[model samples]
Target chain A: MNEADILAVIRDELARLAPEIAFETLDPALDLREQVDLDSMDFLNLLTALHQRLGVDIPDADAAKLASLASLVAYLARKGAAPPP
Target chain B: MPSLGADMEAGALVEWLVKPGQAVKRGDIVAVVETQKGAIEIEIFEAGTVERLLAEPGATVPVGAPLAMIRTEGEPAQAQAIPPPVDRPPPAAPTLAPAAPPSVTHPSPAGRVRISPAARRLAAERGLDLAALTGTGPGGAIQLADLPAAPPAAPAAAPFDFSQMRAAIAAAMSRSKHEIPHYYLSDTVEITAARDWLAAANAERPPETRLLMGALFVKATALAARAYPEFNGFFENGAFRPSAAVHVGMAIALRGGGLAAPAIHDTADLSLETLMAQMRDLVGRVRAGRFRSSEIADPTLTVSSLGDRGVEALFGVIYPPQVAIVGFGKVVERPWVVDGAIGPRPVVGLTLAADHRVSDGHRGALFLAEVGRRLQTPESL
Candidate 1:
């Protein structure tokens, strides 16, 4: 799968995970937590889902890379679709 | 793998604690695994049936390696791909404690008596003894307020944005301060006896295991709480629910982040040495960021001490649910006359913030006075 496809999948997955939050109305520029009240657990769940779906090794330290969709998408592009084995 | 410790690598199928085809609830420990860290029990997060045990006990494989497949109550599990096996003996379980499941045991969230490292360093640089100031952090771990008086340095040219963590803290604290009905109480204590006994106690123990002032205070607090159960319980759902356990919350200030109060469960049950060891382990793990999620959750009551800081007195904000939060100020040389002669003696200031809706100031004062009386006869410890 291409990077864009993977990014779309991640964004869709996050939206599905948190139906209570207005994920569709989220501005690409705002902080994720401020926009959706995503606590630390929610952040971990997002990373866990991405890890399972994409086989990506999202280290706990690199959790900061998920601050915004653009950063997240950019990170996936840099890391690529098939995660490091 | 880039790490040496328990990263997702090199797992061993220690044992199948549950039988195949058995129904298991979410968070049920299905199997045990011996990893480099120790024997960690694998828990299922979703309710399901143990459809199959793919790997036998004593088999070794890299992590993300499946050992068993569980079929959800109604749904079938997808086919799991088996990766190549690594030629290694079943890893031996280390002597260390097993990896506690995050769901089962969250990190203890008793706020440390707020004393920050920067504050400690600043106080030290200014030749200030920290034991004089009252902490304002959770459980009263020393924060910047506990720092000795020093000239303010020039502000940095570029201001830094509040980190997400800090922003969350600001919101939570603001909510706590605004929403919680708070009441304050203060008292003074003579610690002359405790000080002398403490010095002797330190002389006996190894440097690594020396008792800190916080440890002494914790023991004393536990003793006093036994006398005054009302101070230890919380006012919840239009009633006061007293905790059966004397879990003392010691507020600790994280190095560069917000404060957390990790509770010492059943403080009255633990010996001084055991308490100190637990505190040491807690401090080390907290600094290393290895705290389990649950450890940072619910705590009954909190204590905030800045006795190490040079400040004379301060009030602490009451963490919700808990009716009272105790603040400890520095022990200072006070001029008091004894036997018709004026002399300098070490004294402490304590401030207790209670929810007045449940506890009146008079009741709070009585509790503070009881704590003060305990400190005078430190030999009881």
Candidate 2:
């Protein structure tokens, strides 16, 4: 429901997609695809996983904006994807 | 054990999902085998009861070696005695077991040379010359080694060693290039229609069920392959054998390193949604190292897309036995002339690397054109 919670969900889903990636070493400002080597299908999977876990709708057009971890967390927060407190 | 791929020589049995006396129908996942690629769930293709587990877990059984014995429907319980372990030798070396009885070779009343059931099956599968082999067993029965030397046993649970996978791929690709006369062809198809159709379709659906553009390419390729048999079959025994069904192999790159192109069976008949779901499941399982044996072995043709990797196009080497591979590059907006007017249109580069022995450039061009035409009308796909 909080920023940290949203970030944790993103990290978990990304980890599921690319288990080899170490979240602790990744720079949140860098492009996630380049950092983790995610193909389009894996990216779509991440979006789907995030949507399922956070109840957020990630439109195709907005996918480009959520390229980095920081942006993804921010986008989810902006979309009010917080669970009821 | 089934040949998981052209490169797989031996597979280590990881675990048995079925027990002796368990009833397994066709298409059931009965066991898991570890290969250079990863762990592949072995499927049983016949309705039968598991009579016995032949190979022990963690043992690297050579390809064509029996993993389990199954009693098919209507077979008497004592119909056939268990065939001796024909192909399996100690991983270190092929040793003749002194304790085991020598091969029993006896001529039948009709003058047919006697052979062990297991040896006969392996010989038939590999097209071995039975007459050439002097059976070393009790009665000069032709054995598995008489056919051809199986590749050295691979270590168990290699765990995605990139170097090993690279070597296997190199051998297969080298063999493919050496054996098959491959011709390369490329075409740029405008997919504005498909993009629009997919976007609109996905807008109405939830994220979980949304369709990806890759599925459309796969479906279009499958339909085109169904129409063009030359591009949809195996080249074996010095001849081209066209498959009746189109099982499109989708190339998925693993995060760890290397890649796998597992088949999505009967792709032409699946709805777009079904194909998308199957593709998702296949990619997930493939990455997790738990794909089915049929998925690895049954691809009649393969489709490789570098679109996600940002490559404009690629000419892929033909995976042996399968005569052709279709490649798609990243979809990008490029200037195009439609009705004598030049404008920006979204297009993707499509390439086909086909065996010249099976088809000529004329037919290959037609297949690519058909694929393009199908993409123009995405609803039909």
Candidate 3:
């Protein structure tokens, strides 16, 4: 999928985890855990959701690198998580 | 209404999942009640048919008040009269008197009146007759206080709002600190083995079925509790009653503000895969504001974790009735001595806050050590 599409998918999953988080006010560079106050379980669920939706496997070792919104979208793009054409 | 937690004095009935005349077996979710901890699905322990609904959907009822009447097996089908809702006073200090006045008359005394010295002095000073007063103390003993006329019972109702939840938490924690003589001990245990084992296990499993370090900590704690019964029970009425089963309460922080530690029943018997699934389901249901009454009520001991994003360690306050609480902190790399060689290893901070009345520091130390030892071999858990 495109960068914007991947970003949208991430936002949707994040919203499901924390409905109170406002995506418009969320800074893409900020740590998602601090921004949304999500614990480890919530983060794991987010990754699982993204993996199911984008068909990209995010191993636990790479979890630290995708802590921010911008990094997560970029990583999904790098992983070639393209929708079936 | 059932006592969802120690601090839950009252709850508002949100909805009834079962209707009158509906047949229900034991462990059926009967209704939903909104407490300070959010909506809890009330479960019925009796196998019976619903005779009548006592409380309305929006009525705020005190704990132990009748919500419904059930006709058990082999009972006549005769219609039973619905009892009126119990008028309970608002939650207050234990020193406060009950709203209902004690009956003035008593049965003929077989022996001398059992009155406290202080009460005797107070009665003589006040020119009051001790024979006319009823003693509410232990074994009909009169205490040193004048019995005032019973006041009007006030409804212990509060809005089912978030701030009220904060108030409930404040009440519970305050009660815990005031009542429980807490002794805290901290130990940093190496979890490299557990981490490695989890990684290898998860590498072959699907993401949905993969295990987390939390499940291991819970299992270890449960097993250690089984070995050391002192740390797994409730201290009530000046006695410690040990539980036969280890139902570990996992503290879940709510998104809005407060937290709830609901029990994962029979944690010691659950496999790692099953424990992880149950943990995930519990967290999801807690966030969704739906959990069973027994989950909220039947925790023999509590296990709290700050998660990987939190501080190095936390010493939790023992939730009252329960004698102990075990806390797990974020796992971080720290220099350690392994085979007399210093190297970096993944270790997590473990803390135990136990009631001094139930167990001393020596036994508490052994319990913590046992937990650490169990964590060292996660495969057994």
By summed lDDT, which 10 consecutive residues of candidate 2 chain B come out lowest?
Answer: B93-102
Q: How do the residues A1-85 of candidate 2 rate in per-residue lDDT, one tens digit apiece?
A: 7899898777777766666666889898999888888888888888887787788888877876888988988999999885433
Candidate 2, residue B53: the lDDT equals 86
lDDT of 1 by residue, B11-76 (tens): 466555566777877645455454332234455556777777787776764554666767776676
- Local accuracy of candidate 3 as per-residue lDDT tens digits, B1-381: 777766766677766666689887877667767777766777777777899998887778877677888888788785443222212222334222212211121122223555543354335434566778888765577765445321222221221255666766777788788888999999999999999998888775545677788999999999999999999987766788899999999999887777789999999999998999999989977776567888988888999988887888999999877899999999999999999999999999999999999899999999999999998898899
Candidates, DockQ: 0.01, 0.25, 0.13
Q: Hey, what RMSD does candidate 1 come out at?
A: 22.7
Worst 10 residues of 2 chain A by lDDT: A13-22
Docking class of 2: acceptable
In order, candidate lDDTs are: 0.58, 0.77, 0.77
- On TM-score, the stronger of 1 and 3 is 3
Better of 1 and 2 by DockQ: 2
What is the full ranking by DockQ, best candidate first? 2, 3, 1
lDDT of 1 by residue, A1-85 (tens): 6767876666655653344454568877667655665533345456655765676665544655578876776676677556436
